[model samples]
Target: MQGSYKDKEGEEFWEEIHEVSTNFTLFLIFLHIVGVTMSSRLHNENLVKSMVTGKKNLNN
Candidate 1:
């Protein structure tokens, strides 16, 4: 986190970027979880299992 004082008005800029990026990442993760839940329920399929197995049963 150490940076020169000239790095855009001291470390405040970096701190702001870090905070926004972290919050954005967490938001994306939350959206992904909600998406997966809705998709699994709608499709009536084990999406996580298919992800781990790398394939899904086409018959279904």
Candidate 2:
């Protein structure tokens, strides 16, 4: 009976895993914002160019 259920370090292990998961989620959110901003800017630029020249840039 010297080493029963109370002799484990489960709490500390779970805490570390939770912290790492939170940090990874935050990083993914940041990357998503950056990508969306860039894509919107590019789309707007192409639209403006097409309006001025009366021709669509199919390469975009």
Candidate 3:
């Protein structure tokens, strides 16, 4: 690949940035799952199923 940065320091800096961003994104995803699980338990609803089916089960 054609080098975009002028020196090794620049490349290393960007690589670090990429790694940090990727990890942060995964962490955020984990938090999202936790939030969903908590919400499902608190509300006593199958939130994941509803999300997948695009329908909510309502008891009459």
Q: Which ten-residue region of model 2 has the weakest summed lDDT? A: 43-52
Which numbered prediction scores highest in lDDT against the true structure? 3
lDDT of 2 by residue, 1-60 (tens): 655565456666888899999999999999986876687587754554566699876664
Candidate 1 vs. true structure, TM-score: 0.75
Error of model 3, residue 5, in angstroms: 11
* Candidates by TM-score, descending order: 3, 1, 2
- Candidate 3 lDDT over residue span 6-60, tens digit each: 6777889999999999999999999999999999999899999999999998973
Could you list the CA RMSD of all candidates, in the order they appear?
3.9, 8.3, 3.4
lDDT of each: 0.88, 0.75, 0.93
Cα RMSD of predicted structure 1: 3.9
Compared with the true structure, what per-residue lDDT tens digits does model 1 show for residues 1-60? 557568757578889999999999999999998999899889888888899999986766
Model 3, residue 40: distance off in Å is 0.3
Candidate 1 vs candidate 3: which has greater lDDT?
3
Ranking by lDDT: 3, 1, 2
True-vs-predicted CA distance for residue 13, candidate 2, Å: 0.7
Enumerate residue pairs that collide in model 2: none
Worst 10 residues of 1 by lDDT: 1-10
Error of 2 at 7 (Å): 5.8
